[model samples]
Target chain A: DTAVSQTPKYLVTQMGNDKSIKCEQNLGHDTMYWYKQDSKKFLKIMFSYNNKELIINETVPNRFSPKSPDKAHLNLHINSLELGDSAVYFCASSHSFGQRAYEQYFGPGTRLTVT
Target chain B: TQLLEQSPQFLSIQEGENLTVYCNSSSVFSSLQWYRQEPGEGPVLLVTVVTGGEVKKLKRLTFQFGDARKDSSLHITAAQPGDTGLYLCAGLKGSNYKLTFGKGTLLTVNP
Candidate 1:
């Protein structure tokens, strides 16, 4: 069984379009995160949630928002996506927050292409 | 902002060779972790070093944390083709739970 799974492994949409990436994990973890890897391959943390509560919010633009309805799910929704939004988005989960969390288990990344 | 910096962004080595990847940061961290990611796949945890000057060994991989808690390194011995992947270092600084990652070191082991 896959530990962490993401939907729409590949996404191609036009500029100004809206898209969403869904992530789920069955490891019974409480903390989940969203990271973006740009063309330069720099992985930046965008958001993090612990048991459906928002914890970290990086300096991401307002167009991107993350929602966690439950402990097992964290969804990313991007509105009015622009060409600059073309990058790979990843979802990750851990058992807890901070040092208490053993390690992060990542899901297959979603490659988004905005043309 | 706390950030981790990885050296030798790209590495290409022959099988049975040895290599080392370094991760440094300007800020001190309470704990540091190393992760390996394959193409088109998510990263997997390789090791985590918490104490300053701590060294951990896993099979052919050796990880060490700097005494100042501001740097770490991963040394692989007799690297095989299976060892080719992107190695990333993440740091958890004092009072901060978020992981600040480095750009990563991409290793290509040629047979």
Candidate 2:
């Protein structure tokens, strides 16, 4: 079984179009995160949630918003997307505190291309 | 902002060879982690080094954390073609609950 999963493995949309990506985890972890991997392969943390509460927001633009309805699910919504939004989005999960708290499990990334 | 810089942004080596990739930072990290990512997939954790000067080995892979806790390294011995992937180093500082990642080192192991 997949520990962490994402929908719409590949997305192609036009500029100015809004889109949303969904992520879910079954690892029974309390912390979840959203990351963006650019063309240069630099992975950056965009947001994190612990027990469904927002924990970290890395100065991302207002267009990108993350919502966690429950600890197991975290979704990302982008408004008025632009060309710069094209990148691979990844979802990850981990325990809040413990020996393995620092270890994260990531899902197969969703590649979004805005043209 | 805390940043981790990885050396030799790209490396191509042949099987049965040895290679080492370094991860350095100006700020100290409470813990450091190394992850390997394959094409079209998210990174997989290879090792995590928390204590200074700690060394952990995974089969043919060896990971070390600098005594200053500001750097780390991953060494692979007799690398195989299956070892090719993008290696990433991430650092967690204090109690921020976030990781600062380096650009990454892309390794291509040719048979």
Best by lDDT: 2
lDDT (Cα, tens digit) per residue for candidate 2, span A27-74: 999999999999999999999999989999988999999999999999
Q: Which stretch of 10 consecutive residues in model 2 chain A shows the poorest summed lDDT?
A: A95-104
lDDT of 2 by residue, B1-111 (tens): 538999879999999999999999999999999999999999999988999999999999999999999999999999999999999999998777898899999999999
Q: Candidate 1 chain A — worst ten consecutive residues by lDDT sum?
A: A95-104
> How does residue B19 of candidate 2 score in lDDT?
99
Compose the digit string of candidate 1's lDDT tens values, residues A1-115.
Answer: 9999999999999999999999999999988999998877788889999879998999999999999999999999999999999999999998764565747889999999999
Quick one: RMSD of model 1?
Answer: 1.5
Model 2 TM-score is 0.98
Error of 2 at B70 (Å): 0.6
Candidate 1, residue A7: how far the Cα is off, in Å: 0.3
* Candidate 1, B2-109: lDDT as tens digits: 378898999999999999999998889888999999988888999889999999999999999999999999999999999999999998876444888999999999
Error of 1 at B108 (Å): 0.7
